[model samples]
Target chain A: PSETHRNAAEARQNTLTKPPGSLGALERIAIQLAALQETERPCADNVQIVLFAGDHGVTAQGISAFPSAVTVEMLRNFASGGAAISVLARKLDARLEVVDAGTLATSEVAGVVTDKPCHGTRDFATTPAMTPDETAFAFDTGRRAVARTVDRGAHLLIFGEMGIGNTTSAAAVAAALLGKAANDLVGAGTGLDSDGIRHKARVIDAALDLHGLKAPDVPAADVLMKVGGLEIAALAGAIVAAAQSRIPVLVDGFIVTAAALAATRLNPSCADWLIYSHRSSEQGHRLILEALDAEPLLDLKMRLGEGSGAAVALSVVRLACALHGEMATFAEAHVSESL
Target chain B: PSETHRNAAEARQNTLTKPPGSLGALERIAIQLAALQETERPCADNVQIVLFAGDHGVTAQGISAFPSAVTVEMLRNFASGGAAISVLARKLDARLEVVDAGTLATSEVAGVVTDKPCHGTRDFATTPAMTPDETAFAFDTGRRAVARTVDRGAHLLIFGEMGIGNTTSAAAVAAALLGKAANDLVGAGTGLDSDGIRHKARVIDAALDLHGLKAPDVPAADVLMKVGGLEIAALAGAIVAAAQSRIPVLVDGFIVTAAALAATRLNPSCADWLIYSHRSSEQGHRLILEALDAEPLLDLKMRLGEGSGAAVALSVVRLACALHGEMATFAEAHVSESL
Candidate 1:
């Protein structure tokens, strides 16, 4: 909250290429970055999109309408560049890499590069699921992914995940982050029926009871290690790494937001570089968005948590930056100035 | 419906360059045209966006938050290419033409063509504002404008309007078209308070009472003469001309929808080429959408009715058509088929 830096950013906003507030949320993003980098020209050039694939044991609980096979099938889809996110990444000219945070599949599929954190976690209903070491490794996996992105000159990063019952996991993470009830945080993920939703909420509440960590100050890393996925931990690492590198991170829908919440908990300054992509239709998304005081670009009632929303919104961000960098100011355009 | 024609369109849908349903609402548009034009390859190559600018006398009633001057100011904005629709038109490579159907200004404005049917109409709450001759002239203005677009090689059309307080006119038109109550059809036009909304409904009801056209059976042309603005008449005529030319038309938000309703009453076949762009957040938009049984491309809670939604959605349509016309099929990509 340095007023000097914030004022400089605000002044730069008057000079960015476009009309005042023409870029909408993107203008706000650049202004925030101006304050963070303490520079007039804040740039986010290298862009990386990380797809974390995982399989939830809750899929066995029949909480999702789609068969669990969709998880692996979609992983192949993401790898082969056929999923919506794949086309979107190509549209944005971003390098897309897939990591097996914990898919049920044993080995790497033909198109996908495999780095299995584990074959999948133990079912949360039965046990603590993953030990602290596994969780730290997951976070390190994300850090490694960031290292790869930084190596490739990706200055801007977007983290996305694909898992069938990941919404249940996302809701639990949101509950842990906000101290909200599981029922309030849970939603019909990927179009779940009422009964399935009820069961998913119950499962989350039961898992929380087993963990016995119900408060916000329970140490973010410890909470994540006990209940978060390898993909979520990796996403957190990527976020933290992006902050450390001074690269702005564009956060996608529910699952990515959950990852962001976990990351912000670890390093509070990480929030400064983050630009929320959309307000998702997922129930837990509002709580997570509110927790971050994040304003999203689009809200199309989309609950598809494959980072497609982020990908679409990324084009808007790029357009914002381009406008900020490209548009003529009032003086240049010779138009009457409102300010 | 002809079974052969329906089946032929279905077969065309199977062959479009993109996935069967990946284009979403654009797929419906393409298929509807495939059935209408009886072609396997549906093209919107020659696209034209016609903007009808007018001034509503009801502005004196204070139904809208934006002043009446915004009508002329935005007209200048459109002509000078500063508005959202202007940018969208440029992005889509679509030709933009503005028609001064009726404005408060009696004289011509620079860089804007005069398609004026009249200088302006009396406030609708007083009486049938425009005579049948004036309405005919307004409708003829649209028809002539469409001919000009066709002359310019436009095979696809978009209908947009720019008139402050037109939403009041639109709600009355919708109430008349659907036989609904005024309150049900009226909404906060250009952002209004509760009092403004109630006044709008009352004004619409009073206009309906003055005309003695309570039920829905009023002829489309009659409706135009009675309750519609000159721009509304122009829009209705544009739809007719697009239908006559067999060119597909993409309809903008609520006001344009009301225009389509007016056109459809004249000739039911006009609906064949009509594509609803997006449902506006305006209260009456959903009812109009449902009544038409039409699905829009995007839903971003936008109520800016200067065809901005339609223009934004056009990018998606162009993308869909481009993908449908350009991309290889699964058989060609050696990828598994099926969305």
Candidate 2:
């Protein structure tokens, strides 16, 4: 981030025709964007939404409420512009691309980029979710996806994911990073009842116990390979790559945030470029967000994935940029400043 | 609100390709808009922003952080497209009309609608803010403003206020209606120190005690006449008038919420037409929002009262409407629903 541009933007915000700090988070967002983009007048106008889709082998442990096939089917929905992210991408005027990281589908879906290293990861309840090579391959796919957006002059990026049983993967990843029990991090994902939640928690606990990465000395990368899904790793890769390119990333709900936690662990410098979008209805998201010391932009209690939360918050960010760049100064308006 | 439309919209939201209630407040917002618009597809496009600018007699008590001259100057700022609300209206593509509700200006500013019932209200510390007749006239001026918007085919209404020391008026009005002490509802207006806040609270308490409206069953109208500013009463009138005309109102921060509380007391039916846009950084805003049973859309801690909060939130509401009306349903997408 450019400190000079950030300081300049902060000064500009104070000069606008409103009370100091009255616009609250909006003012901070503009200054931060200016710093990240290295421009006095920052904007999120040309955002790129890259959605990573995969299938989680953990579904075999009855961890998810939905069937695994739904993951492959939703990719078709995204391609057809019938999915939430599809509609949001169109509405937000964002460039969206789908990446098939490790879904079970044999053939490629139309409009989805095929970079599958495997059909899916192994069930983490009994074994590591992905081999080291597959983990590296999925991460590179995400990095390449963001590089493509930079080629098109994208200003901001939002990473979305479509994977069944991914919430279990997210829970296990968070538990490992935070040094907590599975019960503390597990919550209903896509409508699980109390019994289902308990069962899911037990599955996560067993998986963590099975993997030696649960220890404090374990590298964050090992945790991702052992427990995280392909899309989650891809999201982590995208976040780091966006930071490297100086394009700000808006992190979505529980699943994407878990990837963000991993990204921050892998590359702590990337933390400055990540903007949290919302607190989801999922109970574990708050813990992950607090761990990152992030105060999210919105909290409409939304828990749907596919980057919907971040896509919705893009409007607020764009508005902040507009206000920062367009509003007249107090001197120009001939209005008195605060006494 | 039309219950039939609301129910149908609720059903439609559930049928979308997401888990039931996974969209959370966005879904509720869309459903509420449908009910308020009395249609299956609700859009907040064609919104009318009526910014009421006035000077408060309470400024005589030195209760504000800014000078009273700002009230009139901001009207010019609004007209010349220099103020916060001016930029917001242009960005949202909403119609903006400024009302000289009761500013101290001798003549009208160019392009501002003149409805000055008086030069300004009297200092309520020693006397009632307005005579009964002036209060009625200011309210009618607000009613007329909404009527004009209806003629132009507005689908939603946003009320913003510009008044120096109006926070004192708003705090006093809220204390009267909610039957609370002044300190419980007083905060920094623009940028007051702790000492200034204490001084403001003392003034409000003394004024409320002198007026005898700090008890339950005291008419809400009497509270407005005694302590409310011209812009506050006008906002209340506009809210009720908008409900009568069947256009939904997106209410701004503290000052406007106090007006909404008064409007609800005067006509409980108007509450259904109101959609809260945000919670403000002002300390007392939460109490008033709770009294109104309102859960606002965005809470960026914004306290700028030029309908700016509502204007910023307009993009979120518009996005919600678009997602609701345009997204393909589960049946249309051929995707499996949650088991």
Candidate 3:
């Protein structure tokens, strides 16, 4: 982000017809976009949603309400344009790309980029989800995916994930990073009842103990290799790459936010390029948001992942850009200003 | 709201590809729209934003950061498509109507409906802001405005207010109705510093004491006559009329919520027709939302109250309806459901 463009945008905002700072976060968003794009007229014209689909080995611990097969089923749904992200991507006129980081089902699906680090991941309850080399491979996969999108003239990047039991993986990563207990970080993924939530929490607790990562000092890559799903590690890499490339990344719900946390942990400066779309209804999302000091654009109590929250928020970001670019100044409108 | 249509919409939502209740408030909003429209295919195709512009005599109390003249200035801004709501209304293709219910500046302006009970209300510190007849007149003005929109085939009604120091009036009305202290409800209106907030709170406290109506049991009409601006009174009337006519009202930020509260107080069932657009950044809005049990669609820390929040949220509401009316069902898409 350029300070010159930010200062210029701030000046432009003050001259627009309304009380100074009356638009609130919309004004801030516009200014931030101006700084990121290094242009006075910042627009979110070219938006793309990259969905990283993988499967969590921790599903073997029975932490999720749905079976692991749902992950593969959803990837197929995404390819068929029947998933939530697909619906939203079409609504926003955004390009949708599904990257198969590593799903349990290894069959090639049309419209899905099949690139696997391994056949899913090892169950983190008894072993690391991925080896160090596999974690690096996934990171490079995500970076390459982002590079492809940016190379295709995509200015706004939205990251979503589809993986059964990935929320448990996210909870483990967050617990390790934030130094919080599993009970505090665990939530019912895909509609768990109270008993199910309790059982899920116990499973995460066991994973945390097994990994011996009940501390905040764990390195980002170490966290991913030990407990993160292949898709999450890829998402973190994409976030870092997007920031490096100066393209704004709109982050989605809880699982995606955990990836953002990992990216920020790896490259603390990457947080500047990330815009949190919405605070998910997921229990641990607020803690992650607070840890990042991220004030999301919306809070619709939406817990569905797959970058749906980010896709929904694309309208607001677009509107912020539209208003910033289209609204007339006080002088042009011939409106009186406060004395 | 038609129960049959609502039931049909709920049934349709249950059959969508996602999990039952996974869409959260979006699903509820769709069902509510279906009920209001009396059709399973709910649509926000024809939307209207009627901005009630007036001047508050309470500006004499130094309660707002900008002068009362800003009320009329903003009306011009709205007319010229320079206001936030104007840009948003244009973006959403919603009709924008500026109703000059009562402004201190009474000159006829292009694109403004110059209907005024008077130039402005009297200073509430020394006297009632409006007489019972004036309050009744304002209500009728609002009801008539809404009637015009509904007659023009507007399916969604969004009410916004443009009045300097209107927040002070709203806070007083909310404080009186909610039985809360002035300090608790008052916030920095239009960039008021801390000292300005304290002064505004003191003014509201004095106004409450002068009216001899500190009790929450005071009549809704009496509260309006005591502290409400002409636009606020008109907004309450508009809400009542919209509800009676079965048109869904997308309630805006703080001042608009206060009007909705007043309408509900007048006719408790009117709350059923209201859809909260966003939780305002204002201090009193949360209390009002709680009192009404309103779950707003968005929370973007927006404090601009020109139907901007409602216009921004119009996209979300439209998307909700679109998803409900357009998304393929589980059977139609051949997607599997959870066990």
Candidate 4:
């Protein structure tokens, strides 16, 4: 980010027709984008949404509400333009890329990129989710996804995921990286009752104990091998790669945020490029957000994931840039200044 | 609002591919719009923003940070597409109508409706803000403005205000209607120092006492005649007219919300059509919002009026409608539902 450009943007915001600080967060967002984009006029006119899908082996323990096969079905929905992200991508006019990171499907779904790292993970309840090679392959998958968006001239990027029991996987990864107890970080994956949630917590705790990762400063790759879903690792890799390429990443709700947590741990310098989009109603998102020191732009209580929260917030970011770049200055408007 | 349509919308929401209640406020907003529009699908595609500009005699008491001349200058700015509302209206593709509700300017400006109600209100600090006839005329202006938008097939309405010292007028009116102390309602309008705010509060308290209107259930027209700016009264009138015409009103910051409070008092039915858009940074707006039982959609700490907050939030409403109407249902997508 360019400090000189940021200072210049801040100076320009003060000259807009409104009062000094009346625009509040909108002005702050514009200045930050100006610095990150290194331009007098920042733009979010071109956005790319990358969605990675996989089946979670932990669903064998009944941690999620839906069948694991729904992961592959949602990939079909994404291709047929029926899923939430599909509708949002059209509304935002953003590029939508659906990747089958590691699903159990025998054949490819049309319009979805089929580059599987592994069919699925081993149930973390008794074994590591993936081998070290599979984890590395997932990371490469995510980096390649970022390269695709950047080469297509995407001004902004949003990472989404689809897996039936992925939230349990995300909670376990976050618990290990943040050094928090599994019970404190577990939540309803889709629509779990109190009993289901408690059971999920126990499974996570036992897995962390078996993996010996219930401590701070755990290696991100090691944690991914032990508990992270393939799509989750890919999401984290895409975040880090987008940051390295200077395309701002709008981090989504619970599942995506857990990926953001691991991404920050892997490459701390990329932290500046991630803009938290919304706080979810999920149980463990608040602690993870606090761990990342992130303040998301919206809190509509949305927890649908599939990048819906970030997609909803992208409109606000676009408006902020529009107001910053288009509104006339006080001198141009010839309006009297404050007394 | 049609209960049949609302129930149908709710039923449709449950059948969507995501988990129940995961979409949160977006789902609620869509259902409400469906009920209001009396259709299975709702929209906010055609929007009209009515910007009311006027002058306040209370500037004589040093209650505001900007010169009263700014009221007229901003009218020119709005006409020339230099004001915040002007930029936002273009971005939202909404119609922008600049109404010179009442100002001290003697001549008409191009592209502004110079329908002077009373050539601005008298100084409310030591005198009644307007005669009863002038208040009535302002309300008629607001009604006619709404009629024009309704004729233009507008699905939504937004009311904004530009008056240098109108916040003082708004605080005084809100204090009268809500039976609150003037000192509690007064805020730093435009940008005031500590000493200036204290003095403004004192003046408001004195004026409320002199009029014997520091009590609940004060007639809204009487309050307008005693302490309201012409633009404030116009905003209230527009709210009532929009509701009567079956057009949803998206209320803006402090001054507009104060107008909404008075509008609900005048015609309680209008309260059902008002959608609180964003919480402002102004002090009194929170209390007024609470009084109206409003949970605004956004809280970006924005205090810039001219309907900027509501305009920024318009896209969210549009997206909500699009999601509600376009996304594939579980049966249509052939996706499994939650167990």
Candidate 5:
């Protein structure tokens, strides 16, 4: 079946409306998925987005430019259809659902549903890593979220994170996954200056040392529980579940890539379902992309850490699918491909 | 009158199909033109792309990564619809017409028209620049091209250029226009590395020093006659034509920006019809943009010196116009704007 899906994708690509490689990397992805799902008309019709909100204890350490309250404000923004991601979802004609995995506030907000497993995690340098049980539950949170999406017939999903200082968390997770120096992966999150970047890197290095972070030889699920955010954990679960259910997942920027890395670590087959949308300008993004052996569709130096990149690339993908599924081939068009 | 156009642009932005600023910089351009034409239904229906092909005397200096033969090859590619710009023009459903104002080649090729006023100019460093008469003819060539497009009912225009070592020419033009050293404006065109960059800078400095180049104090036309390319002259003429005809002319990247600089220098009123497309990743693009006080629509780091960036942004403009023209307002949708 592994070989079967890939072969079908190849055949579908060959039969697509446009000339081979005319749409460049986009055509390649459409064909890759066609083979994976073994369908001629692979559609991202049931597109779903999961917004993972969490509080990073490192925010208290002043690693980010924005206050932690911005995360709550942004979560409300996502729910109220006022944020960039909301506009992007509308642009892609996709539905968005928000999940509050772990925020510092105890009471749940009315608009955004609280799937809060805990208020927030303790600072890694100042405490023991999150309990293994909390980690597992976080991963399950993502899986359950995908199950709900599946119930609504969502075949394509996007996992986006909204949290201040989460870039620090992402850097740590990326460092652990790729076995890179934490400082090299740390970048100016939300437009920090050189001094701020230096401070953020130091913070990540401190966390890595205290946590003794290492790339695991075990499953991605284990890795997520060990050093990942509740949001990252949930995304990992969602990725695995989507693959298991034959759904395609478009991985957004740094945070979401960290989640996908965790998922593939658990089940290598999950990589088959992942489509990288764009290369974030973040320092950690290139390394993550390299680890996944994935090439992004666009490189506009976009550092917006939402599912915005994925949502934008979705238009290109949908166009690719339409071109592949709808365009007349050279044989059909009676045009010579002499060049 | 200027205030009227400005206010009309603002009003049109409010009326366009999408939310304000949703189409970003593109909506700004369409609105500006709507105001200029004093019309609500601003259409890009008769879109004209005038491709100006010329041979830079600098090609003899071995400044480009591509051989001068590429100019001819690509002109053929444009004619045959095989180049990236060709594909993009087709994608945008634009009418592309080629003009061979000058080329090193002595005669016309089969598919391309021969409109050369000169085989090529004398090397600028070793000569008294293009004579006033030659520059005037080149400008006239551009005027005639725009007139033909206007006759064909082109309501909007795009000016494009093709020549090996054109970036070298463009950098010199940008430096002169922006009152900066030529070295500051030179960049690695078509993928030159650090070494190539150093050579380019040195070459520009040497050329400017050798020719005793100075920023033009007069209008852009006279400056163009002294220093601009036949293609650039033609483009400047086209921009003048667009202004006179009240057609919105989308200025492309650095080369087109240079042309705009020339047009505005000659006739300040020509600036009224201009729309700055994406800000190119070209080294001089930012400087050119700043000089024009132009707010470009997209900043995608694109340095593909064809009208590709402008072509892509046209989609955004079309979307804005469509949304402005088609989308249901809150009143029409019977939906209350969230308080």
Candidate 6:
């Protein structure tokens, strides 16, 4: 963090018309942005939403409500401005990039960037999801995507994922990292019923036992190869790369947070660059947020992925910047200060 | 609530791309707007923020950090577009109306309504803050202000207040309504140190004792006359009148919620027309929200209290309307539904 810029922002906050710290998270957000941007005045004018799409081999377990084909279908929905994220991206005026890291379906969508290292991962219930080399390749794909956006003058990056049954994979990854049983971290993905949740948990538990991965001891890369989906690996890569590039990352819902967990585990410094967007209504999202010690910006009980939460929260982030840059100081407004 | 329109909206929500009840508060807001507006397609396009400014005699007790004169000063700042709410009004493209309900200063500001029932409320620390007639007039001022805006095409109303030392009066009113001690409902207003908060609590406790108000029995008008500021009284009146007029009310922070509490006491049905904007970090705000059973749209810890939270939340409300009205249904999007 840039202490000088943060100090300057804090000093400016005290001089605003309202009482000191009255703006709450907005005041903190301004200071954080100042520190991240290394400037007294921070702007979030150029925002980009990078959506990573992949297919989860764990779908073979029949855990998710939707079919794996829905992953590629949603990519087309995103490109055609029919998905939730597409609507939000237009509403927020953010550039939307759909990256197909790896999907079972062939990539022929017009706007989606196809850069898969594998068609999909092996079903983790029986075997590791991805080879180590393929995991690294997915990570590099994420890094390069962020680098390209930063080169295009994007100051803020929002990461979202689209993968059927990806939440099961995220749970498996989280279970390994937190050293918890699958029952503790598993949840209904894409509107699962009670029975579906039990089935999902069993699948995750079997995957963990199959891979012999344990929390806090397994390397992040190995965990990604063993249980993570291609989109999750890419998201982790994007988060780390964004931090390395000094660009802030706005993390979406549960799946994105699992990627953040992996990113922070790989490099603790990446956590500093992450801005949690909202608390998803998905059951295990709270555990992921608690694990990261994250305070999300909103909690509207939204559980839909596709960076929708981050896109919805982008307005608050922009308003924070606007208030920081535009509101008159007490001296300028001639308003009285605290006695 | 219009059951017909609400039923229509609920049906539409189930058909949206996400799962049933997935959008959380956004879904509820859309349904509420439909019921209040009595339209199949609700719109929050014409939004107005009515900020009531007044002075409080309790400033003589040293309860607040800022002077009462700052109320009038901030009115000028609001008019000149230099305040937090002013910037937010511009950003949200909402109309801003500053009402000089009862500030001590002479109302010569160009854009302010200058409709004071009196110069200011009498200090309730010694006696009733307002006479019954004066309280009635303040309510009428609020009623007519909202009526004129509705006549001018405002579909949504946001109520905010500007008054130094008003938090003490709000606490006093809340204590009477909630059957709580003053300390339980008092907070540091505008950067008061710990000692000031204790002093403010004592003042409110004394006022509650002076009024001889017991919970669940105190009449709304009597409570307003006993402890409410002219601006808060006006806000209460506006809320009641807005509900009568079938316009949705987007309520602001602590002081505004106190007014809402009073309004709900006057007519319990008004709560149906109210939408809480955000949860204030102010100490007593949670109590007031709990009393109202309010589920605020945002929890930014904001306590600026000039309808700033309401204005900030307007974006989300607007987006909810847009998504409700614009998004393609499951059939239109050809998205698969959960089995």
Which candidate should be chosen as best, given TM-score against the real structure? Answer: 2
User: Model 3, B216-268: lDDT tens per residue?
Assistant: 59999999999998999999999999998889999999999999999999999
Stretches of candidate 2 exceeding 4 Å from the true structure: none
DockQ versus reference, model 4: 0.82
Candidate 2 or 1, higher lDDT: 2
Per-model CA lDDT versus the true structure: 0.73, 0.91, 0.88, 0.90, 0.70, 0.88
How well docked is model 1, in DockQ terms? Answer: 0.12
Q: Give the better candidate number (1 or 5) by DockQ.
A: 1
Q: What are the per-model numbers of colliding residue pairs?
A: 4, 0, 0, 0, 14, 0
> B207-248 in candidate 2: lDDT tens per residue?
998888877878988999999989899999999999999899
Candidate DockQ scores, in order = 0.12, 0.83, 0.53, 0.82, 0.07, 0.68
- Order the numbered candidates by DockQ, best leading: 2, 4, 6, 3, 1, 5
Question: In model 6, which runs have C-alpha deviations exceeding 4 angstroms?
Answer: none
Off by over 4 Å in 3: A212-216
lDDT of 2 by residue, A1-339 (tens): 999999999999999888889999999899989999999999899989999999999999987788988899899999999888998999889988999999999999999999878998999988999999999998998899988888888888999998989989999999999998899889899889999999999999988888975688567889999999899899999899999988899999999999999999999999999988999989999999999999999999888899999999999999898999998899988888887
Clashing residue pairs found in predicted model 3 = none
Identify the CAPRI category of the predicted complex in candidate 3: medium
**Candidate 6: CAPRI quality band:** medium
TM-scores computed on chain B for all candidates: 0.92, 0.99, 0.98, 0.98, 0.91, 0.97
Q: lDDT for model 4, on a 0 to 1 scale?
A: 0.90
Candidate 1 per-residue lDDT, tens place, A171-233, comes to 877787788889988887766668878998998898888887576577778767666766777
Per-residue lDDT tens digits for candidate 4, residues B207-251, read: 998887877678999999899989998898899999999999888
State every prediction's TM-score relative to the real structure: 0.77, 0.99, 0.94, 0.98, 0.62, 0.97
Model 1, residue B133: what's the lDDT?
Answer: 87
- On the 0 to 100 scale, the lDDT of residue A100 in model 6 is 91
Query: What's model 1's interface RMSD, roughly to a tenth of an angstrom?
Result: 6.7
Top model by lDDT, which number? 2
